[model samples]
Target: MMFSSKKRQRGTLNREQKKRRLFLFTVILAIAILFGDYHSTIASSVGKETLTMITSPDYPPYEFYETKDGERKIVGFDIDIANYIKKELGFKLKIAQSDFNGLIPALQANRADFVMAGMTPTPQRRENVDFSIIYYEAQDTIVASKSSNLTKPEDLSGKIVGVQLGTIQEQNAKQIAEKVPNIKLKQLNKVPEIVQEIKAGRIDAAIVEDTVALGFVKANPDLQFNVIPSIENASGSAIAFPKGSQLVKPFNDVLQKMKNNGELERLSKKWFSANLTEEPLSTNSPPAASKGLNLDFRRIIPDIPFILKGIPLTLSFTLSSVFLGLFWGTALSFFKISGIKPLGWFANVYTSIFRGTPLLLQLSLVYFATPQLTGYDISAFQAGVFTFTLNSGAYMSETIRGGIQAVDKGQFEAAMSMGVSYPMMMWDIILPQALKNILPALVNETIGLLKDSSLVATIGVVEILRSAQIVGANKYIYFEPLLFAGLIYYVLVMGLSFAASALERKLRRSD
Candidate 1:
């Protein structure tokens, strides 16, 4: 009986042990499954999180690109609002900066998550983008040189009207000009440029947003222009989103919260001196009677081949200019450091003029006006490269000079003591290390030149931005083609940055 009881006890113990092991195994498997699912979902979501946004930093009071300590940072009322909405909606913000006209096309290609450049919710813009609540109110006003006779928008007729390309003010200015006849449109890139152009007498008058015009006049007391009490048009600016966005509700919800919390009012007062937040205009307008989002994207697709043909020319222009800039900049740097008073002074003056003047003006002089002055008819492509190279060289000379100066004086002395000539000492010992130190700056400058290369489009160089504009004009769908152009630029810049970082890392490792 005792043996039978012992066997029963052992059997019970074995059964309990088996049950405990099975439970532990099941728990481990469930945990593994849960972890795998979570990780996979995260990976998948990351892959799907491709959101794009387009903006131009040149529009102040709304958007501005700023550089601090050599790092590019975009800031403005529009940027702040966009960032807030992006955070609220739990989406990534990929910002692409460009001329104002490029914003709409950027949206059409699913490249821009939204455009938050304080763009007015125009009937025309409504045809392409889905707009959120109107964020601010602006009245159109005309600004001219303080000395100009322009008193009204009517006075702008038959005279140069400098307006930013994509603003409702531009359209209003055009409409008003139609009444007077033969008004010339001199579209400029940004507010600052518009003011500068008017100040420089490049344009007779500039039709601009009232707030912007006010700011300009206040800043420049000497450059006076009377505001035309005749308001061309009044409109509310809003955040633009791509059509059928799931993020729209979340964005609007957060925008409302911000408004109620007085955040919007605070920002408004901070930027524009008044609270302008109001319920967004109705976006639910039955998708326009026009085909697919009121934009015919297909019309432009046919030009993709021709546009692609320009890529090689663009690359050639970039590479050639960069090469010439580096070579000429190095020579200029040597001349500056040579201590030869006349040569150094000449180099200094050259650098100063190129640095102070706008690249666009330099390009114009090179391509359009230089022929008259120098009696040489330069091709637009050649002139663009020439101007860019010279401008880049001037900027790079300063960078190179700084890098060389940063190198220890002892290195140069050591090479001199070793019986090396001045040129040999610079090339063999100093330049190698100086170039290494300045390599990152050079790469960054290259990226800048790449972006600025779009300026060449103005001279009819059929580059990416110009190509997109052509496409936009043909299709009347402004956002998609511009979006594609911005994407191309962003990808190119990112790739260049990656390469620079990788090279830097490799160089550091070698050190």
Candidate 2:
């Protein structure tokens, strides 16, 4: 009996030693990966001489996609001005694009040196970022279908008025709503969407800038716009910089010189003189979107290659997020089952925080708030991967934990009986079986990530949806590109489903 007792003690001591070694290995590896990732990011930005300017690029005459000679590039009044300033300031310029609403957050995140999206410096916006002197002023116009007869702000009473979300026109619409009783405002992300709403009769009218309205009116002959007579001289467009940015003074100086020398007027004439902002890749004029879905697939044929380019980026993002999430989730699962109070509590709390919050909110916080909170200047791609990893880890930890627990508990005892170390048994014998049990769940998560990859477009990662939006913005038509994008997503998801099913069959055959 004493001999047996000694043997048991020896086994216990061996197991404890193995646990310690496993823990040490995991901690060291995690540290190494994190350090390497952060270091590489820092290194990439160290010697860069380029300054990034972020903009929405959907509003033509200010900024929009100009497709010519089978190449699409952002060009307009704002693009010219930004280029001029870059030349004068002796800095290479890199233009970045995002949602109109996301422009301020990009600056706040240090993601851009300045913003020139025909943004006006309202008191509310001024509180967040510093602005340059007014560069160009534009009047707001009420845009509606020809039959609506809603030409004035007073004419909008009891009618629905659409405005681009986060624009000065939205604020102006609110002021109009205050005076015009029963007028309701509907907000959309882009001017094209608001104009489409008017054409579709979803909204009676839209408050759009005159220069922007010109493009839509020409594109959709059914629409008409009348300028809203101003109560105050309109606050004109200005360049936005992060608070306390040194570039503001220099940017303003260049703008002052441009104004004095008539450079700004020259650019204005170059873009604003024409209702069509771009040289269309194809001369085909898509039929006006009628009451039914009148899709002109030919309109986006020239842009199909552009949309297809995003596939690689989308795939890479999904795989990277999946791999990172799997690694993190595996660790979190071990922590939860480690049988230590602190670790279990930490794992549970972390999972709860991530899982309970909306993924969109989490993504926005990580992309926009990380730089402010951590000073990391994380790229949209990096921020997307990191946020998705954390969020996916939370969900997957539970999935993994269940998988691990589903493995016959007797197998663990059997391995322990043979004097196999706990870590060795767990890694070599248990995890393989556990993962097999959870194969379907993992595949589902992967498919979900593939679809979710489109979310990166909001922060400017130029994936499939953003590519389609760019095409729409350039063409002044919305549905065809979006429908085509939808088709691409459907095809991708179907392909993934087939691959996963085949993998499942192969694994089942092996078993």
Candidate 3:
């Protein structure tokens, strides 16, 4: 009986040990899966190689976003071509988006392996980046309001014509303007913006690529496009790559293959021949000009949710930038105040550079240059935070220095008399008072950062302004969404101001 009982106890202990071992193994496996290097795994799973392609997504029949089931996806002819080439070359594809004007800069910065935005290779562009063989030929068309009857290039004489900035059509319009007398050119960032300008009577007509203008004209019943036949041998769309990129030859080879196999023809027919008029029309068509300022806030009511979604991103960006900028600004303030000559000189030069230059330029440089300089594919959010932190630090450092200097010398003398170390004295006795003194200035800076955060829209961070722009583009209406976005910004700034005031009042209680 004793031997049997001992056997039972041993068996129970073995089972318990097995259970513990299984639990421990499961946990370790989970940890490994969670912390494993994703980049390599993703690359291996997807393909042997990965390449980034950047494009401006606002152009349709070329590249644009479509929202379905509440998720936005980039689609169109260029995307189809890109996928085909990616499969042929056995490389995984990743896409990044930016404004049309920012695309070439993105290539120059090595932010993308190649660009496929239905771009035309121009002499000026060739000087900066290499290009693949022309895959598709396109022509410019004049888009105008139906009543205006400005169909031909000659009709645009003595009138203002709009063109999308940094596009082949813009160049075509420039050439036409040279020949046509009294023609004024207005450049916009996106085709939709140009279309909006036409409807608003801000411009008489716009020069748009035939395919792109078709999409807009079909959607806007009041608008029509007429092909410009005078400009023969019009620019053809080609892929762009960084200067001396190895991918150029391979890309050209695939493009040639697509042409030879009639694949290019198939894609063109699929995208170009299809009628885009089936897409839903905007509910907010403008009233007749006789009706004064016929505004429709109801048109953008559904899109309010989309615009509101940007608030969290805007807040997160602003707060993260402010916190990081404050930390960096504090460190820089110390460097400036430090008696060490090199540190002071370096800090002064740093402040001068950031303070002197435009924030938009700094944002662009940081977003584009980081990948080329460091090989880190920084996200839009990360690039925005880093740029804002760096730029704000310079301005804040000066503010902090002034605040620190304003502190009475007697406080330092008293602390030294008590044998307090310099570091502790600053940390405990000096910074608190200095920060209190600079609270209002800091509040002002924070407000400025919140508003300036809109600039990040250029690089495709969908903060408030970018969100509004996207909605404006998608709905093909401008004023309602933008004015709503402005209201949101005003409300947010006021809330921040009130909060800062309350905090200041509380801080005063300490006195």
TM-score of each: 0.47, 0.85, 0.82
| Model with the higher lDDT, candidate 1 or 3 | 3
Question: Whole-model Cα lDDT per candidate?
Answer: 0.72, 0.85, 0.85
lDDT of 1 by residue, 406-466 (tens): 8999988888888899888888788878888999899988988888888987654667776
Candidate 2's residue-wise lDDT over 103-212, tens digit each?
Answer: 99888778888899999899899899999999988888888876677888889999999988898999989988988999999999988788777767788999888888
For every candidate, C-alpha RMSD to the true structure in Å:
19.1, 17.1, 6.1
Cα RMSD for candidate 1? 19.1
Winner of 2 and 3 under TM-score: 2
Model 2: residues with Cα > 4 Å off, grouped in runs: 1-49, 67-72, 233-235, 276-290
Off by over 4 Å in 1: 1-50, 225-233, 274-511
Model 2, residue pairs in steric clash: none
Better of 1 and 2 by TM-score: 2
